[model samples]
Structure formats: structure tokens, C-alpha cells
Target: AQTVTQSQPEMSVQEAETVTLSCTYDTSESDYYLFWYKQPPSRQMILVIRQEAYKQQNATENRFSVNFQKAAKSFSLKISDSQLGDAAMYFCAYRPGGGGADGLTFGKGTHLIIQP
Candidate 1:
């Protein structure tokens, strides 16, 4: 069974600052995928970042980036220059690397507090 865990239940950062959220996972498969999804107060699930198992390079999207350590089985998300709109519940999820086994397993979530 693959499991994703976000150790930080809540995190706060000042506006325009950067914050890194910790996440770890247990997976036996050599090939798999990880993703970070953000759900704001609106209750919409938005894809923040995604990292492929085979990719040695980390993934970055604007202010969002991921530190993917396949060897340590850890994946962390870094949000740089966070804004007030970035405040939300961030969830880290895992998906098996196979074509048919793409179902996602999600962590509880980390509530991000954006301090003005």
C-alpha cells in the first residue's frame, strides 16, 4: 500500500514570503507519481505541482515547486512569494505509476495561513 503523509497540520507565512511544507510517502513500486493539490475556501481542487518518479529534475510552476527525493521516499512542496490567495488546504497525494492504477491516495491536508 502506498501512503502519503504531510507532517505539518498547519503552517503560517507572511504575504510575499516563502514556505515549505513537508511530505513523505511509503511506496514499494519503483515507478510512481506524486502530486500536490490545493483546495481553497471555494472547495475547488486545484493542481499545484506534480513530480514524476523518473524525472531527476524537480517540478516548478511559478511560485510552486517540489523537492522530490525518490531515494529517501520524500517529496516536499515549496511555495515562494506566496500571496493572500495562496491560503488554502494543501493536500499531497500519490498515484501508482501504471496506466490503469492512477487512482490517487491523499494526505489529510495542511492548512496554510497567509499573514498579512
Candidate 2:
């Protein structure tokens, strides 16, 4: 069983600042994948970053990066130079390795508020 937890239900950041959202998970599988997704007001889930269990290096995309602590079962997302457009609901998701390629299991979400 895999469960994702987003302790903070809401967060705020000023434009051009940096913000980091925390995530923790419990999973029995030793190998799996983790992802961070952003959903703006439009309500579309966009992949922000992904980390593979076998990889030692954390994944990075543009201004988004992840701090993946495999043993601790924690994967956090960091947004640098946050923009007004970045304000949205962010979800941390997990996909278990093998077994029919398990689909994503997402966290409830964290509402990101951006102050101009």
C-alpha cells in the first residue's frame, strides 16, 4: 500500500521568491516512482517533476526541483522565482513499480497562493 501525505493544505509565496512544499509517503514496494503535479485554476494536472527510485540524483525541471529522500519516503517540491501564474493546486503523486504499472495515487493537494 502507498499513501501520500501533504501536511500543508495551503501555502503562500511572493512573486519571484522561492517556495518548497513538503510530501511524505508510505509504501511497501522498494522500487517505485514519485511525481509532483501542478493544477492551476484551469484544473489541469501538469507534471512538475519526477524521481525514479533507482536514481541517486533528484529530478529537476526548469524552475522546479525535487528533494527526494528515498529511505525516508519523502519527496518535496521547490519552486524558484515563483510567479503569479504559478498559483495553483499542487499534488504529490506516487506510482508503484511493476504490477501492471500502477497508476498514479495523488495527494489531496496544496493550494498555492501567490501574492504580487
TM-score, one value per model? 0.96, 0.96
Measured with C-alpha atoms, the lDDT of residue 23 in candidate 2 is 96
Counting only residues 3 or more apart in sequence or on different chains, how many pairs clash (N, Cα, C under 3 Å) in candidate 2? 0
> Per-residue lDDT tens digits of candidate 1, residues 1-116?
88889999999999999999999999999888899999998999999999999999999999899999999999999999989999999999999986675889999999999999
Kindly list the per-residue Cα lDDT of model 2 for residues 1-116, writing each as its tens digit.
Answer: 67999999999999999999999999988889999999987877898889999999999999999999988989999999999989999999999987786889999899999999
lDDT of 2 at 29: 89
lDDT of 1: 0.94
Q: List the residue pairs that clash in candidate 2.
A: none
Which segments of candidate 2 are over 4 A away from where they belong? none
Q: Candidate 1 versus the native: TM-score? A: 0.96
- lDDT for 107 in candidate 1 is 94
Clashing pairs in 1: none
In TM-score terms, candidate 2 sits at: 0.96
